[model samples]
Structures are given as C-alpha cells and as structure tokens.
Target: MKPSKHTKNQENSRRNFIKHAAVAAAGFMIVPRHVLGGKGYLAPSDRLQVAGIGVGGKGQSDIASFAKTGKADIAFLCDVDDRRAANSIRNFPRAKYYKDYREMLDKEHRHIDAVSVSTPDHNHAVQTMAAMQLGKHVYVQKPLTHDIYEARKLTEAAQRYKVVTQMGNQGASGDGVRQLQEWLDDGQIGKVETVYCWTDRPLWPQGISWPEPAAQIPKELDWNLWLGTARDLRYVEKLVPFNWRGWWEFGTGALGDMGCHLVEPPFRILDLQYPKDVQCSVGSVYVDEFKRGYFPESCPPSSHVVMTYAKTKKTKGDLTLHWMDGGIKPERPAELEANERFGDNGVLFIGTRGKMICDVYGSNPRLLPTSRTAQARTKKTIERVPGGAEGHYGQWVEGCLAGYGKMKMSSPFEIAGPLTETLLIANLAIRGFDIREARADGKGYSYPGRDLKMIWDSQNIRVTNFEAANQYIKREYRQGWTLGV
Candidate 1:
C-alpha cells in the first residue's frame, strides 16, 4: 500500500506549491469579495479546481456539468485520443490538455482539488486511485472498476485517504429512487421477494470474433495509453469513441455499461449487499449451420443472470435478483392491461403485497396495477437531491468543498463499490458459461462452466466453486501500468 516513487514526487510538489502560495499571498491585504468584484463574486481560490481524465463524450459532459455548478473550475483535461478530446478542449479553452493522466497528475496535481474519471472500465481504478492518493476528491463514472478486486481496493482507498468520493451513477441521486425507497419503507410493496432488472444494450457487436488484419491506428490516438491495464493489442477499426463495450478486453459489455443505472434502485431499496451465489445462461452465435461459434474474447450476445442474496432487514427472506441484457425482458406482471407497455429497459420489484416497475435510472416508477400508482401515498421521509439526477455533479463538487464526511453524496464509493462488485460477480457466471476444455478422449470439448453455479466467498473476493472464474476478479496490468496499491 506504499505510494510509488512518482506519487511521492507529486506529493512533495504539492507541498511546495502550498508553501509558495501561502508565502506569495502574505503580501496581499485581505479584501472583501464584494469590494473586489461586487456582491456574490467568488475568489479564484474559493472554487474547486478539477482535472478531467478521458475528456470526451461522457467525460465532456461530466466536466461541463461540474463547471456549470459555478463552484468548480475545469483546470485540466486528459485523454488518450485527441479526436475525442477536441470538443472538451474547445469548450474549456483555458484548461490544459494532456494525453497521459500520469503526466497530468505529476505536473498539475498541485493545482487540482478534484479529479473526474470518465475513462474505460479497465483504466478507472488506476486513474481514480492516482488522484485519490494525491488527496484529490474523485468522481468516477459507473461500474466503478473492471474487476471486483479493483472495486474493493478503490473502496478501501476512499476511506483510507479520507477524500470525498462519488461514482457517476446519477440515478442514485434521482427523485424516483427516493420515492421507491419511501414506498418500500411505507410497506406499499411489503417484503420484497424477487427483483428483475433488464436492459436492451450491447447496441455494438458482441459474441463475434475479433476483427482480422488489425486496422491502421488513428493518428490522433495513443493506442498504448488507451490500452492501459489491458493486454497490448493492435488497433481495430470502429473500436474507438464507442463499440469497445462489446469486447472483454477493453469494455465490460452491456452489464457493466447499464447495470449501475438499472440495478442501483433495487440495491438501495432492498439494502442488498454481496450476492451469495450466481448462475447464468447466455445466448450463442453460430458460424454456420453445423457449428455454434465460440468467441471467448467477446461477451455473449445476450445473457440472463440470477443471483441470490441473504435477506436484509427490509426483506422477509432470501431475495432473488435477475439481470437480463441484450434485449431480453422478464415476463410482464398480470396487473398490467394488455395495451400497457413494459419498458424495453426497466426494473421490476415483486413484493408480498404488490409489484412496482421503473425505467432506467429509476425514473418513472409506478406500481404494477397502474391504477394504484396514483392512489398510493407514502411519506416523503427520504431527503431528495437538490436538482435530482442533474444535481449529481454539483453535489460532488459541494461535497469536496465541504471536505470528507462533512456532506453526503448520493453514490459514494462506500455504496458504488459493492454495487459494482455484485454486477462483476454476475459477469463471472456469464463469462464462465463458455469455459471449454479439450476432452481427455480428444474427440470434443468439455464445457464445465455450463449449467454451473458459482459460489462466491465475498470476504475472499473469489469463487470457491470454480477456479477458472476467479481469473476475472483481478487482471494483471500491462507493463508500465499499476493500480498503485
């Protein structure tokens, strides 16, 4: 858990900068903010200085949202691809740009008060951990980390470093989730027994083989940096900007992409924690009429994962949660009329008394009977975020300013870590579905992972029933890359 040499140098640089800043400010007379620039004017030092990693697409909006808070200054931006970073660079013309996050942290850590990580799944742990080690508050995008081990480490680091931390699952801050929680608390849905969360994701290709003849690397991209923590591989066309979600090496498939948003409600309302066991069945692809294609390098086309969690205080008994992706959905509840539509992506909570459903991000929650939705009334006991989901960014900025443990954040590492681990644990079952071994007779193959249930030892962070599935828990980093803990 010792800091790396580079981290140590950054810490020293931060100290020196603070010392010089104080000495330089000694010559200036203290003046009221109103005298300097009229009323309600904030001095530069009053704003939170933020450095954004992977500043493109979601990253662009994430940093922009923070800046919109008027309490944070976008001071730096980092991305492996210049093309993706272009919009962010133009939007925050005053922000310094860097291709490597390590370089940004080394040279600019002294100036950054917070870091926003909107990178690929594989790089989230390292990048976020780096910022946290420098005592910079962090807001990382959803799923937290690519692996359960990484997720656990980041969770522990947040507590160890005592820095304000928030995960990018904005739904945790939405009003819909609070309403759902209030309903459950009021026993509107008495003693939940089962939950189903589904998403029509993986719009990108999956269950397919890797592209043959690697495509030419784009001039604007640094392929090595983009592949940080993942195995070194040649660039393939259509993999940048998006589509990486389909591949196991660079992305985490549909579950990782959408699970945080959809599963978060049940996780919060039910007070669920680590799953006891998981089993899954996946849709397959065929290369021809005779052979079913086996592409272990890619995620399955579709999957249905079932996980069992011991009952929490709110539940009457053990709870079963089903997660389906790639356009699959659960059976509709009979309470709905034939004309009613079940959402393409939604969550269903079945309780002893009734059922409730909601769209992604816990939005538009309604009781199953539909008629009951309007009639149902519950106390507004749970506090709501100022602007609901849109307030997620400003909440984090304010929390950082309030300092650790001073203010509450909707999806801090304490909650996001375990939620992410649960999804990744389910993925172990999905990925294990294809672990094939050559038959001893050398005639065919034996798929031991098929039809098998993985028993997880949460404390140990491994699957006790299947050894092969544990490989995905923590991946070996590529050379020159480290999680730094």
Candidate 2:
C-alpha cells in the first residue's frame, strides 16, 4: 500500500472529485475547482427570475424580501385592489402591473422563472396552477388553495412540472419549528395520541355576528374583481379589504386562516395523514335570516372541531386532532395543571411517554414532565433544518437564489396541498350543515351526521352532491375575470 505515493494521491483525488460532483448535482458548486481551499458553495449562473402576483397586504411584505436579493427580479405585480397594491407596484418599477394575473402570465411567461402567489384563499389554486402549467416555479401562501379539489390539483401540477416551489408558511422554516420536529422524531413525545391547536384570529375581524342582506359595495374596492372566481354576489363594505376571513364564500374561517400555522407543526412532526372522522360545532351567532346580520362577512362567533386521524400503515396508530377558535381551549392535559392555558392560541402534543408544547406557528417549544426529566449534563447538539430564514418572504428569496432547487422548502406543495384540503372541508361542512354528514373517504372526505354522504372524486373535482353542495365547492367567476387552474 505504501509502495507508491502517486497511487495514494490518485485515490484521494478520485474521492474528492466524487464529493464535489455530488454537491454540483444537488444544485451547488464548490468554490475553487481545485477543491482544496473553497470558502463557500455558489449557485449556478442561471439566477432565477420571479414575479409577484397579488401584492397587497401580506403580499407587500412578502414580495420585498424576495426582491431585495439580486438572485431574482420582481418582474410583475398583479392585484385586483389598486389602492392596496399601489405601493408594491411603485416599489418594483421594473415590474409590469396588471389587475388580472391570468393576463400577466400569458404576456410574461417567457421572462418569468417563478411566481410569488399571495392571493385570498379562494383564488390560490387557480392562480398557482395557471403559473405552474406555464412551467414556472411558485411560492404560494399558506392554506394553498380554497377547496380540496384545488389543493389536490396543485400537488399534482407541481409534481408534473418538476419546478422549484415553496409554500408561504414561513413559520415552518423557523429554528423553533425544526426543534419541534426533532423532538417528535426523537420520540420526546411518545406516540402523539392527541393534539390541540388554537388561534386568536379574526383579530383583523373574526367572529362577526352573521350579516344582514347584501349591502352595497364600497367605491374604493373593485367588488366584481374582488369576487373573482367566487359566486356572483353584491359587494358589501364589511367583506372587502380585510374582513373576508370569516365568510364561507371567500374565506376558510379561522381554521383556513390559521390552521396552516397552528396545526402544521403536528402534521410535520407527527407525519399526520387525512383524518378518518371529522365533526364540527358552531356557536349560535346568527343574526340574519340567511345566516347572513353584522356588516362584515366572517365566520360564526365561535367554533370547535374534532378530527380523528387513523395512523397510516407505517405509523403507530390512531391519533386525534382538535382545533378551537375564538379563545377556546380543550380540556387541559392533567400534567400541566398549573401551566397557563394557551391564551390566544397554541398547540399541545400528548404522546405516550411525554408531551411537548409549541407556541402557535412553533415559536417557543418546551418539554412537558419537566420535573420527571433530567437535564443533560453535556450540551446536546440540536439538528437545524435549512428552511429557517428570517421571515417567510426572506426564506423564499433565498430558495429562489438556491439554484438547482437546493433550498429546503418549509411548505412545499406536496405537504401543504393535503393540509389545505382538510381545512377546506371544514368550510364545506359549515355551508352544508343542514344537508348530510360527509365522511372521510378515499376520493375525498365527507360531512358526517347527514342523511346522504357527498362522494367527492377529488381527482376529477366532481361531487356526488353536485345537486346539493357542488356549488359551494367551485364558485362562478365574474365577467371579464376568469382564472383556470
């Protein structure tokens, strides 16, 4: 073996070359081809270019993070609300502005490498799918789509297109969230038998007393465009700008608005699949004849939902997930008797061995059974996930720059699409409270406690209850504005 120094050097060189080649294949190139004194990894020269669609409210904040980096350019800004999106449009002078995203994609497909989609829950799927069809990567916001049909389609589209993607649940990228995942993976929380997640949303305006008959639309808002992809309805002042979180037509209630944040930790850490049984109860806050009295359209004053998820063939067993909104709390776990209840919202994981408490969106996590557990004598190394960038937008920007899709995505469509579908079903249940209880099935879940079950073929986006509630699943787009996903 020591006969020739040349032979030894040749073997070492071969190993080094393999290592560098692996790095390059994963979309990274080691600096200094010599491989002896490289400082940092660099992305390939095809720096990605992106467009910002629906740059209003959250979009404004989200778009800037990606635009700051030279890796991508904010080539387009699209929004139905002119006033809300004006600042973003002005900020990105290079981007072409359009009220309709469909037109923007058609005109700018060649120049765009990806899109940042931060529209309302209802329009997410249509806009995202359209962009994907053109072979563009997408960074869509949480609660990926309005309905189950749309969510499933988005997952398929992303897989088919093989484009880089990241979902807008920035919390998923946080160090705290990664810690939660590690804790679960290490069985810190034994078999997670139950999970309770809640939030104090509608802080923007939720739990509004049901509204009266449709009111006149405000002049500042584009009522028709605002209702894009939604059924025709006279615009009301209460629903536009920021109050849509509560309404069945446009929003997902608190669950849709916050579930992706509050429940996601458990889903990821616990590897949860669809629930086998789902049931919900809403408080008596109705003020109008049509279940429509307050000015703003939102959800009931309060609601509690219980979902039972059966363990997959590979998982341990059955698990129960509970969601509460409007300052509600499930029966506290016996161990945390003195621990303060989740004031506005938080998630609790109850495992066979021990439980973990993670703040909503996985901000701060602490172990339960503190008294019984011993502190480690030596400092333990914690594995950090790559997605935690500062805010959600910043992470997406970094991902865009991460050529060859090397970045770790927190809410990739694969993980987010199903979660969105589960939350959207809760909305469907609210609208069809009177008809029939649908059961969770292979094609899609159904509402239980009803006389007839709504058979949903999610692959086809059709429903057995077409005569009954299909109208609720898919909305009619207003004239002059049509979106295809």
Candidate 3:
C-alpha cells in the first residue's frame, strides 16, 4: 500500500537524522561556524585569531593592545630578528613564532582571522597586500605604504577584498580630533584655509651618507629576510632597530614617521584628499665653503613642503598644507602669546575667523589664544572611540568580528590611503629637490628639480612637469619581491 504524504515525510526525516547521527558516531565532528562561513567568519564566543608580522617594537605593542581587548588571541608572531621578537615571545609564549611572514601565512592562513603589520616602510606594502589577499583584516602602521603607488593599491585591495583595515595612526581614533571637528562644525574656527603640521623627528639620523663598513649581522636575526623588499645591501650598524628611519632605502624619513600623527588631524578635519600641486625646499649640508654635501640616499635634515588642495566640503576655498620636519616649524600664530609654547610636534589650523592648535596625535586641542579654550562650548557631535587612542587595536578586532562593512573604523584604509599618499607626495617633492642632471657643458650637474613646483596629475599619479621626479611615485621592487596585487 502507498504511504501517506506526511508519513513519507516523517520517514525521510528520520533517515536523514540517522545518517547524520551515524556519521557523528563514526568520529566526524560538526563543522564550526568559522569553517562553514569561511575564513572571514568568527562565532561570537570565539576570540579573533591574530598573526603579527614584524612582531617587535610597535608591532609588539600593537598585538599586546589587541590582546588587551580580551576578544583576540595572539596566535602567531613573525619577525626577522629573534632578538627584537624576544619580548613578544615572552608576552605570548603560546603564540607560534616564525622568521618569515610568508611561511607563517602559508601554513596558518586558515587559522588567522587578522594580521598586524608593523614592519619598516619598504616591507609594508608587500606584507600588507599578502595578508589582505588571503582574507585577513590588517592593521598596518602609517604611513600606510613606502610609496604612493602602494598606498593606492592597498586602498583598492582593502575594498575589493571586503576586509576591514585600519592604519596604525592611533591618533585618528583620539577624542582630541573629534573635539577639533566639533569646533569646526560649530564654526568656532570658521572654514580652515591653511594648516601647518610639524615634527622634530629624525632624532636617529638623516642627511648623511650610508655607513661604509658592513657590520656583523646579529646572530639571532635573519639579515636576508629583514631586507625583504629593500635592495640587497650589506647590513650596517644602527640601521637595524631604528636608524633605518633616515634612509631612503628602508624608511620614509621624518615626514613618514610623524606626518601621520601631526598631519592627520588637519587631514581629517578638513576632508582633504590629494594635492593638486606640491613644492618643497630642503635644508642642505655643505661639504666645505664651495661644495654642498650631496647625499641623495638620505633624507634632508629639514624641509618645508607646501601642498595645495582644491576646495572640499569643509573648506571655503582651496586649502594650503605646510609640512615641516627636522625640527622646523611654522611661524607662531600672532594670537598665541610669545610665552605660550608651540609644541615641538604639533598641528596648527588657520581658519578665517580663528585658529586651533593641537599637539602630536591631535592631543590637547585648543584655540589659538589659550584663554579662548575655556570659553568655547561646542556640542559633542562625533562619538569618541572607547578608551580614545588606546582603543585603536580593540576597535579593529571588534570590526573584524563584526564582519566587513558592519562597523565604522576611525582610520580605515579609505581615509588613511589618501592621508598617506599626501605625506608621500610631500616626500616626492623633497626628494625632487635633490634631483640633478649632467650639465650640457659637462662641468658639473644641473639641479633642475630644485625650485620647481611639481604639478601633480593625481589621476595619473605622476608629476606632469618634472619627468625625473615621476620616478619616485612607484619604485621597482627587488627581483623576487612583488606587491602581489
């Protein structure tokens, strides 16, 4: 006799349950939410699995901050220098360690939900791109990339891969920037027309020739891997750990080191994008009374770069940004008392009606005249990040768990990419200042790049007038390295 439809349905359901139960009894485990949803998924109860590349110094602090969130597990640590990584190893004894990021990514990509890259400038692009390609959320140190081209590519990749990304400019998440924003929104400062960002960085060294002698490679460090995308070169004393900041090969100089911290407040407050034109003058070192020291390999001791941006929603007209480094600073605002300290590292916004100033990381924002800070009362329109600057790591971790596009990030790649590009473009003009060509008479070199206002075609990412300056927009990687775009 034919079975009733409901009875048949019940029988089918029982058969399916028995099949699944049998499979379970045979030692097959149920797939986890992460496994079923792919690498991007994280069950609410599960902690984010994080892999840290260049896990030393800032990288060490970055992972520690993430772990502080109590919602992340520092599962892996990769650093070329074991000595540099030793502290992190002790901090996260359970975290597996590797000398090469590529190897770590290869074997453990499935286990890692996110990656933090705190390596030197040159390696930033390749390491970041590799992780983003594998579906890992990334928190990269600023300036986001060593070159302008890398910044653009990583920005596009972050969107294409649909991964949450935050640049490690913790200042972007600070409450101080929000206060400045609120003040601007309330017309307390009026429309900002000019900005000055300055830093006294390069305390390591700059405007010098590369050390001639190769130093003994540290026993615990893998020198070859440390070089990464940088041109194969002999290791020199002090270049490791920190002095690399002054060199063109591995670092982005003072502007790169502190620009993100100082320039970021103005960049965010004004809604500025790429610059239409940039020109710079760099302080020079003299070999003697007659000859100037020409160390093209090193960043200048000081530079003043002027970048002009077309009008934005936050501005009444075109905006001018001045970036000063190597202890240089803009002239003190007339409103600021002579005795009032203009911070060594600070940002000054000169609006039509008034001026606002803030120290590095956009901290201690106040009106130009110290007395006005107390009188100004602006509504808090922008929500402050929990724990302010310190919350940066946790913010990214939470965003990753929430899935892409679910949460808003303070320094997401969308904002950071252009901010980074802006600083690098200033570097381009500073580098261009040293460009020299063989004289037609063959007596000496002609410095044509000097005193030139580089007209930037932002769409093409090139300096239209100076063909020589264009070479720096994107550098050729060492033979084996690729951005993997």
Candidate 4:
C-alpha cells in the first residue's frame, strides 16, 4: 500500500531541512563540543563525527579502529585511489565518499567534528592543518609530516588552534611504554644514558633509481590528487598503495615509517628533545663489487644514525641515541642469552647502573641479565590507558569529545612533534651522507658530507655546522599546496 499523505509530508520536510542545513553550514565552520556544551555538561557518551582522508591501507584500518570504540561515526571518506578505498567504502556503506579532501572538508565541515589523516607523509601537514583550521580535531599518522619544518609548524598550530590532536603512534598509548615508564621511575634500570632503536623495515625496495619508462597511472587512481604537496611526476609502478616509503619525495624511509613507534618511548622516558648533534653512515646500494649505486632520491638500503641530546632534568649528563634501520641490529646485550630472540624491532636503553630492553612500542620491557627483571622495580606513576595501546583510538575520540586540553594524550603533537623532529634530524644526517660533490680529478664524486656531524640549532630549526644540510629542514612545497593557516 502507498504511504499516507501525512507520512509523505513528514519525509519531504525532513529532506528539505537537511538540504537547508547544508547550505547554511557552508558559510561557517563547525563549532566544537566545548563551545556547545560549555563547562561541566559534556557527557561521556557523546559521539564524534569523523571524516577520513586517504581511506585505504592504514587509513582504512584507522577508521575501523575508531568505529570499534563505538563512540565514533565514520561520516565521510576521501581518497584518490578508488581501489584502495574500496574496503572502507564497503565497510562504511552509509558514509559519503569523495575523491578530493578539500571538497569533502568544505562540503561536510559542519557534519564532521574530527579528521583522520592517513595519507602519504608528504601530504600529512597540509591535510591535517586544513582540518585543524576548521576547528576539527585531528589524528594524523606517525612521523607526523614529511619535513622537519612541517612537524614544527604542526606542533605550534596545535597550540594556536587549541584543538585536540593525537599522532598515529598507537604505541604511545600502549601498556608497554607505561610499564617501562613505571620501571624507570622505580629505578629498575637506573639512569638511562643511551638508547638504541632498530627496525627491519623498508621491507619494500629502497636505494634504487626511480624506475624508468613511466608506467601508466592506474585507471582507479587520480594521479594529480595523489601527488598532493609533492611535485607532480609521471606515475611509476609499485609507488602507489605502498612502496612510496623509500622515496624522499613521498615516504620518509625507515625513520618516518617506524621512528615514532620505536623512538617515542625514549623521548618520553628520557625527557629528550631536539638533538644537539647528529651523524650517520649508510649501507651503499650495489650492483656489483666494483661500483656502488647512487640514488639520491631513494633512502639507503640501511643506515646507522647517531644523535646526541643535551641533559634534561631526567638525565645526569648528555644522552645519546642510536637508530639503525634496514635490518641493522645492535650488538646483543651480554645479559640476554645467545639463543634468545632480539625481536625484529627493538629498543635497548643503557642506564648508568644497568640496561633495559623492549620490543616495539616499548612492549615486553625487561631489565638486563634477564634475572634482574624479576627483581623489584619502580611503582607505577603514569596511569595506564584504559585499553592500553589499542586504546589509542578511543583516547583521541574521547579527547575530542572533551575539547582541547581537557583530556590528556600520550603523543600529542607537542610531544610527537619534538620526537618526530628528532627523527627527521637523524634523517638529515642520513640524507647528508648521500650528498655528493665532484672530485677535482673527475674520477667520480666525493661526499664532503660523509663523516661530518651536523650541529643543530633547534631554536632556529637549522643545522649550524652543515650549511648544506640546513636546506632540508624546510623543503619547498609544490606550487599548489601550502601548509594551511
């Protein structure tokens, strides 16, 4: 039977009201919760309307995690690659989809309270900055931005915008870091003076020249939009959906890929900040025994970067951090059994009195001598996140509901920023190692940057010792993109 006249009228009225609301909201930014609820009236049950950019791979998983909290409604999805976003579109059938983030943000700003940025590293700062400028809280992926300048600006922007923000380093919210913090407070490993973080990453290709004979851009992807802040270039096979991590123009290699997850613990536990100095050595890419491949656009096959930080209140003297990637590992601690597993990724902290080790996210923390771990330890000081590291999504969602500064965060930009900048500083050393100058004899190139230590002027955001290295601190953005105000 057909609907009655009254029911049909009510349905028509609802559609008209929604259309009118959209038109009216087009002129204004969405007001945040704290503004609407004022003080002391917000409820724990408040749901956040979240929009996702780059809704594929990690981006798809991130939105799924948010929805898992039962407190977030995935209202919008944006991605340039249709194939990559297929999963999210299927998962959130009710959500609106867009190919351009700027269009999504502009049309749906009033309906979205937060934005999750899981795009390529190059696009992170610009995308997240746009969302924040609209008064929308943000959850950006790890390593935050592609450049040191972008990281610093985003950190300051967080304060300027007074918005709730969390980095994608879920390990920051993990139980591992908290337990390690407790052990440190209890003096389980004494005073940490050195940190070693290593990862077997790039699991994709690196240290190779850009593929020749540009491949056709896939029909499923919009190439120009995917380029984002990076200069437009011919589409190459294997660069999309992943593998971009090895290219300097896009991904940040191993450091940007895993530094936030592994280095964050040390940053917090040691109260470390911008490194005063950085140096590095990288594994050369080789085609044969006679000659080495030189691909400046690609990250090295492996690297060992060392950074020095001045003493913080938490340290008795200067501290050193050693980061190794491309499957490089530090020497095994004497305390660990020869047969024991060192894990594919791990962090080792050497304190004055003893040492401690943990896997990624500071998980499975153990003191040196293995037996020592069974001994008495520090009492827990930092309150554990409700669901541990997995709670990362909920914490950000809840914090957005609580408004700016009203909720505590494990890796807010204020914290992740410096940590990321520290990693990017190490990146400078690694990239500098590849800097080549022509030899007078014309036999080949001489790398003057090799073995030089870059002394960083953190306040100035530039390297004092190496003028050439300073150029990378704030790289030029592509013509159409700007880090939003």
Candidate 4 lDDT tens digits, 1-485? 99999999999999999999998897466566656778754443477999999899999999999999877899999999999999999999999999999999989998999999999999999999999899999999987999999999999999999999999999899888887878787777677788899999979999999998899889999999999888778899999978999999998999999999899988998888889898999998777999888999999999999999999765658998999998999998888898988888999989878888899887888878778778755676788899998899999998998899899998899998999899899999998888888899998889988989888999999988778887788878889889865
Instruction: List CA RMSD, all candidates.
Output: 9.3, 10.5, 4.0, 9.5
Locate the minimum summed-lDDT window of 10 residues in model 4.
38-47
Best lDDT among the predictions, by candidate number: 1
Tell me the whole-model lDDT of each prediction, alpha carbons only: 0.93, 0.70, 0.92, 0.89
- How many clashes (backbone N, Cα, C below 3 Å) per candidate? 0, 19, 0, 2
Measured with C-alpha atoms, the lDDT of residue 436 in candidate 3 is 90
TM-score against truth, every candidate:
0.93, 0.77, 0.93, 0.90
Indicate the TM-score of model 2. 0.77
- Candidate 3 residue 138 Cα shift, in angstroms, is 0.3
* Candidate 3: worst-modelled 10 consecutive residues by lDDT: 25-34
Tens digits of lDDT, candidate 2, 106-154: 8989988889888888778778888888988899887887777677778
**For model 1, what is the error of residue 436's alpha carbon versus the real structure, in angstroms, after optimal superposition?**
1.0
lDDT measured at residue 467 in model 1 versus the true structure, 0 to 100: 98
Which candidate would rank higher by TM-score, 1 or 3? 1
**Ten-residue stretch with the least lDDT total in model 1:** 26-35
Between candidates 1 and 4, the one scoring higher on TM-score is 1
